[model samples]
Target: MKNVFTTLLLFSCLISAPSITAADERVKIIPDVVYGHKFGMALTFDVFQPEKPNGAGVLFMVSGGWYSRWTDPQNMLSWFKPLLDEGFTVFCVRHGSSPKFKIPEVVEDVRRSVRFIRLHAKDYGVDPSRLGVWGGSAGGHLSLVLGTTSDKGKPEAKDKVLQESDRVAAVAAYYPPTDLREFVDEKSPYYQRFPALQFDKELADDFSPLLQVTPDDPPTLLIHGDQDKLVPISHSENIMQQFKEKKVPVELLVIENAAHGFRGDDQTRASQAVVKWFQKHLAKQAD
Candidate 1:
């Protein structure tokens, strides 16, 4: 039973797909776009361009359990249809997986992907400054990391992508683990299952979103289920408070009676909320 629960918490985030419909046909997909390379592996993401674009981009962190898995971009069309219909081009980003790489390394790969995307935003017809990111579970954790830990580019860097800004305009995360300090000591109930958390104890607070929030952090939306035992609603609540104290724009949507993942009507509501959050925050960036 413990193993089954762990598996569900790890992979359930990927199962919140809405049914495929004609709306999928309105988007053009560009797949396997490499953003960076490390240790002989390519970091890549897929771009889904709406027929009518709103000039903004939203990167969907393609992660669950810190394991970035590849899926048919076609199968994801329905999942992205909400964002596409709103004229936002979507980037499904995959990062280095865990049980091989640790959490810090996974975070670095995602930050590089953001910089790479910002560097080529014009090529994708997206406004580089008008970007947002989102995900659930481990992906959500990454989104919050991006929101709080984003940095201005190193102008002295020789690599052009490294010289590009990694900041995003907004973030929306679902049931993210905000504070990873509990896992630093391997004390969390999930420590054994999520190998990504098996890292140096000193590094936990450095990557924790709750501890990293600052006044300059981007607008953030956090959605969680009240009954989420895997991540717990407190993760969102605590970070929401930090965002508030820092005077950063933030909102929390608590799904009643839901668990680790949303299903049926809950998924629909969660999907719609994410679309609205991105639209509200990403669409209004000044030129």
Candidate 2:
């Protein structure tokens, strides 16, 4: 029975289709970096860089449920190995999920993860100036947070890492939840409350990416499925509207029949477009 249980756990960790394992890459925790860990909440991320890098990198967040596993960097090497081959360093971020940890706490952790990475860039062979972020759904919301709520160059306590800005150079999101307060309609099924005692709008509009966009933000690419039932196209549509108004350099990719994570040709193309965006934005750097 012991051996059987072990096998099942390993299988669950490995065969989980959407997960990316970080075992083969650099995996470590920047201790006490989390705002709160009373529920075992902590911030950790995996790093994948070329044996010899050219000078660019990205911090990638996985869209796990607000309460489930989203990525394992060890397995992700197979999917994003091509990017490493092309000389880009990849950071697979892992943060505490909900129920135990609230939604806002997780958001703060994502920002800390990016801030930690940028603070330790030299030790990891990463080029801090070229850092970017990517994700979907919940993770998308985080990427936006890191992009918009940049630290004001102030240190939290004596930790040098906390002083680092969480700002990202660019963003590539797929069917992301651009607005959290308005995400659920009567037709949706996910939990939309922070303990049944709060309205989402009171959660802070600055954290909403679509609402945070300014002329100063970096260029971005938004992709969505027109028929998505989980996160409707309207999320991206409204963001597109906001970007247009500010005249920010934003691009949108709408697929007619695809839903959620793209599969088949659409998936391949989405991956390619992400690589291209990183290369274009991150590569334009100074020594």
Candidate 3:
């Protein structure tokens, strides 16, 4: 059941899954652009530029259960049409897969991807400071991590990418596990399935977005199904509290009666909420 829900959640990342049409021509795609390298393998992301761009970028973390799978870029057109129609350059970023990379390395891989994008923002016709992020489940956890824990670049780093800040203007995370401390318990159910969570217990706090929030963290929107059993709604509720306490702009949209991954009208509503949240926070920056 867990595995089934994981697949369902990933497939439903699309915003209402619209059918592709000739209008797809309005979006130009640059596929497999390498961001970094790890263990001799290239880390990559695809860029989708709408003809009339808003000059802001929204990176969708391509992850499910910490596994970053690859599929035909063309198939993603309808999945991201809502954002593309809004003139946002959408970046579909894939990190190193889990069970091999683990959460610590996976987190760093995504951080590097953001830095790489920011370093070359001008070439992509985007403003580095006007970036936002979105994802679900494990991807959502990563998005929150980036939102709350992003840092200034290391001035002495020899790698140019390492010298670029990874901050984003806003974040939208769906059904994310904000606090990873539960995985630290050896007997916890998540520890057996998500090898990505099999990291040092002491480092759990470092990766948990709930523990990383700061007052300056970007405005965030969290969406979760009230009935989600895989990752309980409590995850979002708990972090929502922290965001409120810190006075960071935040909103939690709970979809009543929905499960791990939304279906039918629930998915559509969640999708619209995310699009609206990004527009509210990122549009001003684009202007």
Candidate 4:
């Protein structure tokens, strides 16, 4: 009788397991959709649309160490499958790489991408007001900038896309450098790496998301490893403090003993946290 009960329980559990449907798959991929032209180079993005969408979209900034590069959409499809599983559309946003474009120019490119996405939200089957952004390292820094900066559209702009606000509804980033001015000392590698930003306090502050936090900024989630040698955990801590002071919705997760880029279970945990954050913040709320 006991053996029979165990067999029945196992069968029940197997039957209850979630089945993979066609709607759970990423069915559409639109590559190299040009969002802007800069320095005679085209700024493009790739959209990964799920077979079943939740009316929300996420923009993933494809940047690392201040250098932006093109990434194969298939390579990132697995990394973003969690978001896809939840029926969220994903966009891989690419900006002009550094050394040729500089940080400020990269910032503008990202902002423009956000505006472009918002302008065409309906065509993409996403709610314009329900967009989120996420990234790691330099991409994370740019994501924070999108969270904090809000601009009224220019009425005279030639492109209608430029007239949409660049603001994002939610943000999630991993180990981002929030303050450029804080790392301007002679001993800091970031100071030497980006020489163009040195001695320019105004420009540094302009790019610093820590300095840009406002009361009306979008909800934000930051995840950083406690033992991160490249971008310290204090970066997120300081920014979290600013977010609190300004009454912005923010949360910081510090992964114990993890490094700059999370590995093993730490990476999984960070990714899961990001998925939940967007799920909560990007949901369409009643007015």
> Which candidate should be chosen as best, given lDDT against the real structure?
3
Cα distance off (Å), candidate 3, residue 110:
0.5
Every model's TM-score:
0.95, 0.80, 0.95, 0.88
Candidate 1: residue 121 lDDT (0-100) = 91
For candidate 1, list the clashing residue pairs, or say none.
none
Worst 10 residues of 4 by lDDT: 7-16
Q: Write the candidate numbers in order of decreasing TM-score.
A: 3, 1, 4, 2
Q: Write the per-residue lDDT of candidate 4 for residues 1-287, one digit (tens) a residue.
A: 34422321221122123444454454588999999997788999999898888999999988765566665665566677789888899998989876576678788899999999999999899999999999887789889988887686676899997788998999999888898876666676566665334555557788889989999999999999898776789999999999999999999999999877766688789989999999999997888
Error of 3 at 116 (Å): 0.6
242, model 4: CA deviation in Å?
0.9
TM-score of 4: 0.88
Whole-model lDDT per candidate: 0.88, 0.66, 0.89, 0.81
lDDT of 1 by residue, 65-96 (tens): 88888888888887888889989999999998
Candidate 3 per-residue C-alpha lDDT over 70-180 given as tens digits, one digit per residue, 9 for 90 to 100: 767788898788888888999999999977999999999999989999999999999898999999999999999999999998879999999999999999998998999
Q: Is candidate 1 or candidate 4 better by TM-score?
A: 1
| TM-score between model 2 and native | 0.80
How accurate locally is residue 89 in candidate 2, as Cα lDDT from 0 to 100? 80
Q: How far is 159's C-alpha from truth in model 2 (Å)?
A: 1.8
